[model samples]
Target: MVNEISNPAAVVDEETFSVRRTIRIAASVDKVWRAVAEPEHVSRWFGLVALDGAGVGATGTMTFPDYGVIPLRVEAFDEPNLISYRWGNDDAADARPDVLDPEKSTVFTFTLEPVDGGTQLTVVESGFERTSAPLENLESHRTGWNEELDKLVALVEGEA
Candidate 1:
């Protein structure tokens, strides 16, 4: 059976260790899922590409031409709701402080919740044991997720 745990309310922000990052997006769950889950759609907004992962139990890859390609394995895929993945590649770029550990995969999750105006999308990335990889990765992703989230909002709102 899959083990699911509720995300903590507070994030860790220490010096030596801690792995937690959360960002919110403005869009419906369905819209966000479309913008993020599908390979074609994801390439248009989020990452460079979406490999095998499309539906539940899908495994593939995501890449950034400037950086490199990383293997992506989907774990939790609940349509129009949640999508989780393990990302990392063997390329040298994956060794950077900002990049995730290729040996130790990290968990990338998207949680959608309904709100007054539209859906609220929360992205939480954890499982960063390697300090160097998470360093630059965490900061870079901070901006990346925000931009991608906004793009998803635009795509969904425009369709509506």
Candidate 2:
């Protein structure tokens, strides 16, 4: 049988620094990547609390209503294959700090590959160091990825 989903978080020093989720869709890898890398398509499922949208090298801010706004920047792009970006430090506390960890801000990547039965989509987000960033930082992202991946899977399979 083919695998439909896989989310193996890469752990470092007992804490998950990054959360990676992958889903095997019935559609082509290109189709899956488009839904992930495009702005309007990502807005359907990813908008934080409010949607600012996404595009290659485009920087935007997402409003979170009660959570304030988080700025995001696209750092890499390879059509239908890879996309990386920098976002606010996931470890930032609800209360703002005088200084944010620049290194821990983040760089997320989405890698798409065609598997034997379907498309294998892998998302790897790494930037947090074991000691500097709070463990909660990585945990928050772990939860967010779970929700986002579900939305992505639904969006792609549901569409014609």
Candidate 3:
């Protein structure tokens, strides 16, 4: 039987200019890591992810059906434990270039931990203060994480 973990929605902190969410999934750390770090599995739960390669500094694009493609780069990674991505969040940049704006991009880090029943995943997206619209973007991303992570939990757990 699968463990019923209560995953909460993402939270937006205006003072820190970030959004955070924690979820417990009934799956192994390796499995959960792939779901979040691998391009193929990431696309299944998040947006359509297309990455140049693995490891830090690898560039990529996540395309949402209505939102267009957002340029992203793997900022950091540590095996099946943690990974972070820096992505463009500038709404004014309608062109959606292939490069990330150092001034307008946000960094989102995913931390995974092994738990009693499965794995605990925490995602913190920061640097919203640098975005064109901090409040607007923060709220939007807060909602986005909640929706996205829920799908991630479902996908990983279902595969177990």
TM-score of 2: 0.73
Clashing residue pairs, backbone N/CA/C < 3 A, model 3: none
Report how far residue 157 has shifted in candidate 1, in Å: 2.8
Ranking by lDDT: 3, 2, 1
lDDT of prediction 3: 0.89
Q: In model 2, state the lDDT of residue 52.
A: 41
Tens digit per residue, CA lDDT, model 3, 59-106: 989898988888999999999999999988578745366768878899
lDDT of 2 by residue, 23-134 (tens): 6766688878877777666667776522245456577655454456666777788877888876675544442322234554767788888887567787877766632455
Q: Candidate 2: misplaced stretches above 4 Å?
A: 1-16, 48-56, 91-101, 130-133
**What is the C-alpha local distance difference test score of each model?**
0.60, 0.65, 0.89
Decide which is better by TM-score, 1 or 2.
2
Candidate 3 residue 48 Cα shift, in angstroms, is 0.9
Model 3 ranges off by over 4 Å: 1-3, 93-95
lDDT, candidate 2, at 46: 76
Q: Give each model a TM-score.
A: 0.69, 0.73, 0.95
Question: What is the number of backbone collisions in each predicted candidate, taken in the order shown?
Answer: 5, 0, 0
